[model samples]
Target chain A: MAQHSLEVIVENSPGVLARVAGLFSRRAYNIERLSVGPTSNPETSKMEIVVNLEGHALEQVIAQLDKLINVISIKEIVPNAAKAIVHDTQPDYQN
Target chain B: MSQMNGASSLVASLEAAGVDVMFGIPGGAILPAYDPIFSSSIRHILVRHEQGAGHAATGYAQVTGRVGVCIATSGPGATNLVTPLADAAMDSVPVVAITGQVPSVAIGTDAFQEADIRGITMPFAKHNYLVTDPADIPRAIAEAFHIASTGRPGPVLVDIAKDALQKLTEFNYPNSVSLKGYQPKLSADAQSILDAAALIAASSKPVFYVGGGVIKANASRELLELAQLLGAPVVTTLMARGAFPDSHPLHLGMPGMHGTVAAVTALQKADLLITLGARFDDRVTGKLSSFAVNAKVIHADVDPAEIGKNRFVDVPVLGDLKFTIAALIPALKVALAKNRPDLTPWLRQMNSLKAAYPLGYDTPKDGSLSPQYVIERLGKISGPDTIFASGVGQHQMWASQFISYENPRTWLNSGGLGTMGYAVPAAMGAKVGAPDTTVWAIDGDGCFQMTNQELTTCALNNIPIKVAIINNESLGMVRQWQTLFYEGRYSNTSLESKRIPNFPMLAEAMGCVGLSCDRPEDVDATIEKAMSINNQPVVVDFRVNRDAMVWPMVAAGTSNDEIMIARETAPDWDSQEL
Candidate 1:
């Protein structure tokens, strides 16, 4: 199944990470790549979450994620084709 | 444009990052940074020593779950913070240490009070920076915080030279940190989770290995659900002591070096080992090759590096434990329904093993008080939420055996480090972290006296942590070994003749309430009185039987099966004597 990436912006505070992670965890969705860091704005931080799921599963993940109060924005970041190719070239490192 | 000194800029950056407190002691080398400390909004806590500063910052950080900030001067001042820094690093506590170095020109010169701070801390710290230029101060502090708070969080040191602190620079704090090689893997492979679930379903005797990562990832609910669905016994690591409720029927206490016999046996007999968020430390795995010999290991951890670091992992699921557990639970539910394996016989055997090796103690019919009685009573009074922190030796083992820590993070001991004088400071930190929760420091006579000076710190901060000192009048754990292995040589282990401080008077001097329980009957009353008083710290000197020893002890350099079931009673002794 194809995996989709969801970029979410949340408030930079304690328990925010727990709440967002808890949401996906409660639904039993598999999160593939989750990278969180501070955004340009001081109050908000960007969380890049790549989840492995089909189209219907991706919609469910987005719908459930949108309900979180701290979530400021959500978008899909396209998987870098070059990085994927490089990873494929180095099959030894594949997890 | 007007330029500010590097120290001022460093202070400004820390203030900008919302750091309200800085813990440290002032010294000659770090005097330049001390000048700017008072001007900044960050409050400076002047500790008795740099070690105390490191511990205090650790306490502050543990409570807030933020990056703990501590400062010190070069050489000895910086060296004093080494123990606490190592403690933080080993336990994965987030800490940022700022040390003032000698002048940039004095590098490698070995001048008076000039030591290689960076070189000394390189092995210990998560990341370290040596800033000779004033321009690097702001960036260094920001990077230090970033590295300290990120994945597999640990202590980060920033050594600022005297010249850099005094030099002028245009200050600009980087709003964000970008490190190329420091990315923490936060997601698991979908196939790995499925494979792990499939393995769990197929195996008849499966065990869920829980650790501190479940608490860190906040995946307890997912873990509990999976364990319940699969009907697997949960064995926790020392660090993950309370991940599962100890009272639960399926929960087989802790496993490894000092683990319960039932837990160790369960791990040995299991066919599938689903390890969650636990690094297979040597303490947990006696012999790596022999550990879980019958089991196909499925290791799941947030840190990818820990996947195959210790044992050969058959299935590796690398991701946030909460996410991984959440996904694996449903898959396991489906797998369990399809493949129904009978584990009743295994569980019955485990139960029988537990019954055979029940943790017991023989209290003197009428003599000096017993530490076992005190700890057992403590387990009863203190709810599951209560946190029990202990120092090294017999008292720590007694606490481990007697206290049923049913919740995660409730029992904080210096397990890997075996650091003495850890209980009092760690309890102070746990109390600060969870003010509403009851925090007890179970210290031995030897370990209690090591850091009893910190009673003043507790009193000053109004941290009402209850301390129960098992006063055996000697180094009990070592004495037990000397008595058993060293043929009763009893060399320097005896503290019987050594003049010790009057604990009650010492507690009073530290401006805290004190109690002494010489009789087993007084244990309950004293502990109750201490718990009731919330205004200040309380110390209860539990004068236990000097000969009392921690039983079910697996002697050093011996296998787990060679456990000593009874203290004072040898293996070949007659059963009728009991």
Candidate 2:
């Protein structure tokens, strides 16, 4: 299983948060991190969900979540395998 | 246009949206909304409880294909509406629940009767809105009804703060709704339809697995046309009980746990399964791996999310079932003309299995009545279009097995949620929606205690629906589970016979006509008498054998091979009770 981060755009109506949270709980999907915020558009909200699942299961979860009436679109954020370069200007503590 | 306050605007929105009646209770917080209903065109029925109001709305929606509206106040009233909202969500029933909330200023301060109803109902409703501004009332209501009745129909909630209702604002109802993110899939792809048709034409062993979506889509006629064109047997799931006529030669009855042997075998042996608006629910699919293993499945539903949620599909056609099935009829006929699979052998086998294991129950030498016999006789006596609602457990199973449903929307029940107190309130809603039809709530003794207060609602509103309580004096389904799986522990399950507040007496106390019939000979006559009463609601308590259990059972989490027939389970049942 691998952790995948997904961004979901849905109608900014009351209870859309609960509906998303409920889908995770009822379907027994593992949620690592979840957050919701208003989009530039006043009528829509954006949700970020990090979940751990293998290939087919993740695809099914995404499909089911997309089926929700209020949900408009979903985008999976690909992981960056490349490491950030670190500056070694200071000497080691032991030295 | 006349100037209207938030309360007037709310009531006007309901009236403008074509809502004829609503079910709910008035409270201090929601008093503003209630005050205007007196002068408004919409009728309001005062319910004994808020939960009854919710379920009544569900019942109304289930029968009429309309968005049922319900009202309740904040805090306790809001919490009470939760169950019905969850029930509606699970069953995909269309309903709009409106509740009064604490004033915006005192919302988080925990004022009197203050509760976050919008947050509480978020998980269950299709969507919810909290209107703190009176100007948003008309638009919010229009959107709510649209959301509730659209694609995969479900409940929606709108919680208006008291301050919003108190504020004066000019009412301007929106003619159309424009929600940026709430678009439903309204059309299907032609390639998937043609591919599904191809699969159907190539398979000798084919079955049309129908469900509630077909009924919700109002595609029963389309379903029948397709079933006949395909020359395949049709097996409806519990929720789809009346979607297809039970008396049709190609109809194999209900499938899954507690379903008929023919229906189960047909689904098990089918080479191509055309699943129309039916989800592959755990109850319907005993073991996902083993269910229709050989069949190439075609899953057609309005909601794209349900396409591959459970079962892997060869063709996932997403659109409304009524339109899809109607389209599929001509496509299938064309395919058949070119190449048709010989289904004569498949038809013969289905008929033989049905004849061999036809649903049977013994007429006991003793005078005690059999619940199955009572239901079968009730079915025989009632009209073809007679409406029947059922509570959860063995009685629900028995009703599905014995009663013959010839038309859609005639059979209503809590299928997905398995709610116990559903029938009483749901039947009341059905009665209100179709006043000309005879509505009967076939309930269990244990289930009746959950929501029988609706009898007062029925009596007061002059809804002359009938109720039959199969009073076996125990939680039959739970007791059966304990008997088979828990080594007969029985604990806290049986509501012993001769208990206080007997159903008949309880019915009478609630202002409904009550009748009790313990003898098998009096079963038909009692139903006849109850049916004759058209002025007020009637409740009949049929004292059934306590040890009787629903057979053809597939124990939970088990495979198709684990189904226990009647004779195989008879010896162990009631062994500990004796």
Candidate 3:
């Protein structure tokens, strides 16, 4: 299984986090990393979730999440793209 | 804005949503809401248990094509609604469940009669809201109904704190809901429709694998038009038993486990499968990898998640089935105009398969009634217009197979979740929803004992639904499996329920007209007697043979190619004689 990251923007209402996270647990997909915070739009929050799953499984997870009524949008962040930017900024940080 | 308490506003919101009926049992947390229900125009059926309320709501929703509402209080009452909520979620029934929660301040303290229902139902509910603020009642309710009824419909829950219900608030029912993330695609893309049409035009062997979405979308007419145009055989899934006319010329019976040989064989042999609204459920697909491997699939569904969730989809048309088929008909006509593939041989083969392996059950050598024969007679006597609700198990399969359905919303059952105690309450709800129509609950003895208390609800409320209990003295389906898999060791499957609580006496005790039948000759007269009683609910206990099992079986997780025509009798799929 490969790690994939998804950035989800959703209505920052009570239990929205549970609703979003519940899909993964219900489907038995293990989450590798997760973070959440209010976005520029006060009404909505942004959640970043990373999971280890195959391509088809990840696609199903995305589709299930997209069905939620409170979820505003979802985007897949390329794992390498973020690493490349960090590398360019500080090449010797990890070393 | 009108001034009122939150509870009143909640009821008012339901009224505004055009909900005329609801089911529930009042409890501490929900008592406040009941006060307003008396003054409101919505008719509320008081059920014996909270589970009954939930399943009744599901039944109401299935038959009416509208959101069914069920109310319950916190703690056990709220938790009791879980099964029905899960059932509704699995079946994609539109249901709005309202549960009372502990006062906001005491929620975490585990106050008396407190339950975190919103938290409990998060996994299954289409959407849920826990309203703590009195001012939020109207908006929350509006959003709840909207979420439950739209897109791929399922159960939605709204839990209100007791204090919130009691607190005085201004009720301003929203004119419209603005959910940024909840727009369901009503129509398919033109290119996708065209692609599907081209596939349909080119394929010599095509089958319309119809599912419940056709009924949910109210697209049966469009489906009929498309099937007539393409001249492909139609196979309705269990969840979609009545989505297409059973008597239609191109219709092959239900497909999957316990499905007709003709329907299952056509699906197995088809070159192109036009799968509509039906998910490729494990029950339907049998062994997933080997299932219809040669068939190219054009899956059209309202939910995109369902398209490739199980099987590979060659063409995915994401939209409401009504709109998808409406768009496809014109495209298919155009495609067919150029190169029309004659489907005569394919249709001929389907007919031959259907004729060779027709759905049948032999009469028991003993005098005991055959369950299949009972169901067949029941269906024939009730006619096609009657609504049939069944509890999950052998009886449910028989009802699906024996009954000839010509209209949508006429068949209701727990297909996905396979909940056992679904029939009684669901039939009650169906009766309420369609008061002019005759509704029958075909339940197994094992299943009947689960939620038969709803007969009281039906009797008291004057929802005169007829109940036909196929009493086989055991969990027939489980026994069938045990007989097949195990060395005939019954192990806990037997429920000597015939002697205990005697169904007829139980029905009479619940204020319903009770009748019992042990012989096949008395089945019709008993049904007629039960049917003639329109003043109150009627229960007919049919003591059928315990050894009888649902045949044409694709034993769990096995391939449809290995379907058993009878016990140890596999169909000869390799033969070219047909």
Candidate 4:
């Protein structure tokens, strides 16, 4: 089991974050790092979440989160994909 | 349809959503919306408290299979709605709660009766909305209903600012919702169905573990067909009392906590457990470590998260309960035709266990009243059609254990939330939803106090739901726990006789016909009289012995094998092993 990261896009509606957070906490999954902000599209927001979980659990979490009414799309950050996102954001982190 | 203010638009939107009725109380901020309520086709039943409104909506939804609606004003009114919303969330009841906020300008200024209801109900509700613009009202209303009724049904909230309600806007309710992220998968794939079917066919002993989802999906027929095909015993959970008819040959009754010995034992011995629409709740599973340890669990539910939330399953089929069960039938039939395991020995063992550990409670010789006797007698008198609602505590457990339900959604109780005072309002809502059904609220004295004011609402609204409060004079369930674990030092659990309100008198004060019976003989006659009243609400106070406890309990966190018949007595099934 290793830490994984994903970028999620969702409608900027009230309680959307709570729905995702509540789902994770209900199953006792802890988010190691989480961040959400407005995306290029004003109507939708982007959320980045990092959690320590195995393949099956991560798949389940992503699938469940994707099913929320406000969620638009979710993309798991593969190693190559992670490097690109990191380079674009220019956050203080190195792979 | 026409240009109208936000309040008018809200009413029209509700009518379009097929909302015939709503349970709520209007106040300062919500008063604007009430202005147009009279113009709309929707009927409003004024409730005493917001919590009562929410639970009444839950009861209505549970019976009607529709999205239940509730309305409340700002601040405390919205705050009061929090409990029932949480209750609905946990139980997966479809409820849509609308609360009025202070004017948009004063929203964050802590203006009179203003509360961030969106933030407050966020964690508990499946979805919530804070409508700031008048034009968004119609869209918000449509989305709220869509999200509330779809997938795993749950509570949704829409907090409308007062100013927005007064703003003029063009009214046109949306025909469809566009949610990119939300898609409820309603059928299991072929591979999982075949796998589960093979397991069922291979098992010498199989148990069908059904829960409230079957009731929600209205899939009791499908569940029964599958159970029969597998020739398995069925263990219905508290929330799924009537999902499989209690009198059916396969029914083993409710399992866990205060569950029957046969039901628990059958599950313990099962080689395969096919769970439908139920989470492995601690109350049902007892000690999580050993629960259904010998069984290969196949959990089928609409909620993907629930598949492995508590107990890991060999097969996790994510889909709507009805669709999933229907799909399993043909596959199970095919598997059975190829090879059917001999279940004769398993059936023999189960029958003996049931006969030996049949649900039995003694009606005292010098006889004060037995709560179990009251429940069983009520069941016999009322017939199978009666809608039984219960508040939390010992009386609730007694009702679950003694009363037999023959149809889905007939038995209603706060299983997951364990909220007290749920019965009165819920019964009223159930009666409203299913007008022909005889509705009864079986409550405990301590629980009766929490929201009994709703009884007054029922009387005023002309909803004639009968209530039978088991007046045990103390918080019996807590007292039972205190007795078992705390050396019987009663503490504050006892309700002082002199200080406690006379329940019958209280019912009378609320404009209900009130009666009292402490004698076992009086139960039959008094209950007959209570059932005969068709024109008005009735309350029967059965002042039962405070010392009486709900038996056959697996003490909290204890394994099923450690189930107790009474305070210190191991159940017969377990005693055999010892």
Go through the candidates in order and give the clash count of each: 2, 0, 0, 0
Interface RMSD of 1: 16.7
How would you encode candidate 3's per-residue C-alpha lDDT over B1-578 as one tens digit per residue?
77999999899999999999999988898889999999899998899999999999999999999999999999999999999999999999999999999889998998998878888998888989889999999998998898899889999999999999999999899999988999999989999999999999989999999999999999999999999998899999999988889999999999998999989988998999999999988888888767887899999999999988887788999998889999999999999999899999999989988888889999999888999999999899999999999999999999998889999999999999999999999999999999999999999999999999999888888999999999989999889888999989999998997888699999999999889999989988898888789999999999999999898999887788889999999877676333
State how far residue B338 of model 4 sits from its true place (Å): 0.9
Lowest lDDT 10-residue stretch of candidate 3 chain B: B569-578
lDDT of 4 at B180: 72
Clashing pairs in 3: none
Question: How far in Å is the alpha carbon of B195 misplaced in model 2?
Answer: 1.0
Can you give the lDDT of residue B318 in candidate 2? Answer: 90
Stretch of 10 with least lDDT, candidate 1 chain B:
B569-578
lDDT of 4 by residue, B1-578 (tens): 67788999888889888999999999999889999996777889999998999999999999999999999999999999999999999899999999998999997898989888887776668888899898999999999998899899999999998889999999988989977777788778889888988888888888888889999999999988888877778999999999999998878889988888888888777888889998888888887777777888899999887887666678888888888999999998899899989988887777777777878887766667888898899998998999999999999988988888999889999999999989998998999999888999999888888999999999998899999988888889999988988999989988853246988889899999999998887889999999899888999998887777888988886778888887688865434531
Docking class of 4: incorrect
TM-score leader? 3
TM-score of each: 0.81, 0.93, 0.97, 0.94
Clashing pairs in 1: B242-B407, B242-B408
Candidate 3, true inter-chain contacts retained: 0.51
Please identify model 3 stretches exceeding 4 Å from their true place: A79-95
